[model samples]
Target: MFAALAAVAIFTGFVDAIAGGGGLVMMPALLATGMPPHFAFGTNKLQSVFGTTISCANYTRGGLVDWKGNWPLAVLVFVASASGALVVQQVSTRILAYIIPVILLMMVAYLIFSPRMNDEDAHERLSRVGYTPVAGGIGFYDGFFGPGTGQFFTTSLVALRGNGLIRAVGNTKLLNATTNWAAVLVFALSGKMIWLLGLSMAAGAMLGGYLGSRFAMKHGARVVRPLMIVASLGLTGKLVWDWFVS
Candidate 1:
């Protein structure tokens, strides 16, 4: 079972590194281990931390991440995510279920149809000050639901901040790492994680993350944009299904 979980983690890490729907893969796989849903969520977070950290490191070393400009956003993401987790129990997620899919579909349409959307950076629509709120809001969304946080971050950077695809992906990894670790800490404190299972999966995730990052680095926007589009569509489909089914 552990070996099988690790294998799934490898693939999840790879898809997650390139796009951002890793949870779409990892969560269902974890549930198949017969773990309780809460424990699965916690364990998934533990393994995801490893994968995201590796991807972030790879992006940083490749000079794709804007560390100096993005550190503040990372910090904000952590805090905002933590706060969102704390407040989640008090709020109904039905609103998000209805709204997020629409937004995600809009993002998909924009990415698909926008002629100017390319690998190259363009003029910025939002300044650093404007981006702070955006980062904080997305971080909160990650903590609260977290299906397509990576896609959201990448899209926002590319469309709003005028970043190239490669750079947007790098920054997305960093912010994703921050939010992931923040949620992991909360889950760890609640004693929800199965450390043995999570660590085993992490081993696989680390390797997958490294290889995926390398591929993204080599392929640039050609790979990332299409994956982003797929991920966004997938997320939208899932959200719509859940909303209708419920």
Candidate 2:
């Protein structure tokens, strides 16, 4: 069971590090262990922090990330995510269970309807004021609901800031990592994280992170778009099933 779960985690980490939906992999694997839903979610966050951290580092080393323009956004995301995670225990997952399907449907629609969006040579059109609110809001969302946060950040940076898809994805890694670490702290303090499972998954995630980042760098935005679309659709299916069947 452990070996099989680890294999799945590695694959998920790679896909997630590149495109931003590893939860699709990690969550189910953890739940398969018979952990409660809440604990599974929390533990996923813990493992994801390490995966994303490795992703961020890999992207940074590749010169795909723009840290100078993104540091402020990271700070805002950290604060907002921490606050949201702190409050997570008080909220009902049933609310998310209902809302996620709707959100996933919207994401699929956008991915399908939007004219192909690629920014090979995009110049910035957004100021800090314009982006700060968006960063903080999504950071809070990451902590509150926890799935699809990467897609949201990627789309926002691409549409609003005029970043190319690949750059946006790379930058999203850093910001998402920031939010994940913030949530991890809260989950850790609450003893909601399962270290054995999380670490086992993290090992796979780290390898996935490196491989995924490389794939993203090699292929660029055009290649990632279809993958993102597929992941989003799968996410929609998963959320809908969880909502209706659970």
Candidate 3:
């Protein structure tokens, strides 16, 4: 079971490195091990954060991250996500979950149709400062509830910041990595993790993240844009299915 899951972790990290829906694969694999749902979610964070951080590092190393522009937003994202984690039990996110599929579907359509979704930077529609509120909301949503936080961040960067798909994805890794730590902290405090499995998976995820980010930098927008669309569509289906089951 551990070996199989480790392999899944590698693939999860790869996809997550590109477009941000790693949980789509990892969560189900964890659940199949027969742990409780909280354990599954917590363990997911425990393992996936490694991939997120590794992917972010590779992007930053590739000179794709705008440190001066994005650092403040990263700090805000961390705080907002932690705050959301604190309030998660107080809120019911089913309504928001229902709304997400719609948003993801819209994102998929835009990705499929948009002509400007390339690697070259374009005219900024919203300044970095103007993006704080949206970034905060995504961070909060990731901590409080999520199936598609990566896609959300990537699309926002592309559509709102007018970042090309490549840079948008690179920065999305930074924001996505920031979003994971708070949830991991909350889950650890609550004793909701499978440490042995998480650690095992983390190793695979780290390798996968490294390779995936390198691949993204090598291939650029042609690869990332379609994967973003796939991520969005996959997430939309997951959220919609969950809504129906719930």
> TM per model?
0.94, 0.93, 0.94
**lDDT for each residue of candidate 2 in 101-175, tens digit (9 for 90 to 100):** 687777767666765456474655677678899899899988877878988888778777877888888899999
Clashing residue pairs for model 2: none
Instruction: Give the total clashing residue pairs for model 3.
Output: 0
Alpha carbon lDDT at 242, candidate 3: 83
lDDT value, candidate 2, whole model: 0.83
Candidate 1 to truth, TM: 0.94
The TM-score, computed over Cα atoms with residue i paired to residue i, of candidate 3 is 0.94
Off by over 4 Å in 3: 90-92
Candidate 3, residue 179: lDDT: 84
Candidate 1 versus truth, CA RMSD in Å, comes to 1.6
User: Number of clashing residue pairs in every model?
Assistant: 0, 0, 0
Worst 10 residues of 3 by lDDT: 85-94
State in Å the error of residue 165, model 3.
1.2
Candidate numbers sorted by TM-score from highest down: 3, 1, 2
- lDDT of candidate 3 at residue 146, scale 0 to 100: 60
